[model samples]
Target: MDDWRSQRIFRPVRWRSRYGRAESGKMHGCADLPGRMAMARKAKLGFGDQATTLVARGTRVTGDILFRGSLEVEGEIAGNVTGEAEAGAQVRVLKEGVICGEVRVPVVVISGRVRGDVYAGEQVHLTASAEVEGNVHYALLEVERGARVSGKLMPAAAGSGGDFADDAPTPGMPAAPK
Candidate 1:
C-alpha cells in the first residue's frame, strides 16, 4: 500500500470513538472504515448487446471504419466511422476517446471529444463530459448538463441523408451566421 493511504486509512492509531471513550486501536478501524469493496454489477454493454469492436486506449486508427453490431472507442480515430444500425447497432466513445472525423451510426453515445459531425439514425446521447466541434444529425438526441457543441444540431428528416449544407436552418435556433 502507498504510504499516504496506509497511514490514513488502514494504520492503527490512537483515537476516540464516538461514545467519548478512548479507543486503543486503529483510527476509524470499525466496519465503517471502508472494508472490502462490494462487487460491482455487470454492466450491459451496448444496451444489452455486446460490442463487436473495441478501439482500446493507447491505440490510434487513421482510416475510415465500417462495422456491424457495436463499436466501443476508448482510443483515437482520425477518420470517418460508419456503422450498420439497422439491426440495433451502436457506437460508444468513452471519456478518454477521441474521433477527428465524421461518424454515421445508428446510435451514438459520446462521452469524449468529437471533431467532426455525427449522424445517428436512432438516437444520439451526449454525456456531461462530451465535446463536439461539428454539427450533429440525429433522429433523437439527448444532451447532458455539461456537454459542449460548437456546431448546429440538425434534425434528420425522414428522407434527408443528413446533408451538411450550412444554409439549411435548424428549428428553434436562428439561421447560421455567414
Candidate 2:
C-alpha cells in the first residue's frame, strides 16, 4: 500500500470521490477542447458570438433592414440591407437569395442575385453563382470565375472616410464634375 501511494498512476484514482467523480470536475479525455477554446476566443473578439439574423427561403421582406452583427439571406429582400460600419458586421447572401435594393456592410459574401448597388467597407466576395446588375464599391473585392456583374466595379479610395458616393461614372457614361 505504501508503494502504491507513491506511484504516479494511482494519484489520479486517489483524487476521485466515493461516487467515482473526479474532484477536478474535468473530463479525462475531450477531443472538442480545442474547438471550444477557439469558439471562446471568437466570442471574446466580438465575432461569431452575436446572433445571426436569417431570412429563410420562400420568404420576402419589403422594408429596409439595419443590423449590427450578421445577417444571412436565403430569400428575397426588396429594400436596403445595411450594417454598422467598422463594427465587424457581415452579410451573406446564399445561392437562392435575391435582393432588389442596395446593400451596405463591412463584409459581404454574395452567391446570389442583386439588382442594386453594393458597398462593402472591408471586403466583398462574389462567388461563382453570383449575379449583380448594379455597381459594386469595395475596399477589397474578390470575384469568382463564373460571377457576373453588369455594372461598374469601383475601389474605395484610401482615407476617403467611408464615403460611398455614386460620383464615379460608369462605362460609356459622362464623368461627374468635381
For model 2 the TM-score comes to: 0.65
TM-score of each: 0.62, 0.65
Clashing pairs in 2: none
lDDT of 1 by residue, 1-178 (tens): 6667757765766667677876544556564343322322224244334557899999999999988888999999999998876556789999999999999888999999999988887789999999999989888899999999999897887666533334366579887553
Q: What ranges in model 2 sit over 4 Å off?
A: 1-49, 165-178
Clashing pairs in 1: none
Q: Tens-digit lDDT track for model 2 on 32-119?
A: 3577689878777766456588999999999999988889999999999998875578999999999999999889999999999899
Model 2 residue 80 CA deviation (Å) reads 0.6
TM-score of 1: 0.62
Model 1 lDDT vs. the true structure? 0.82
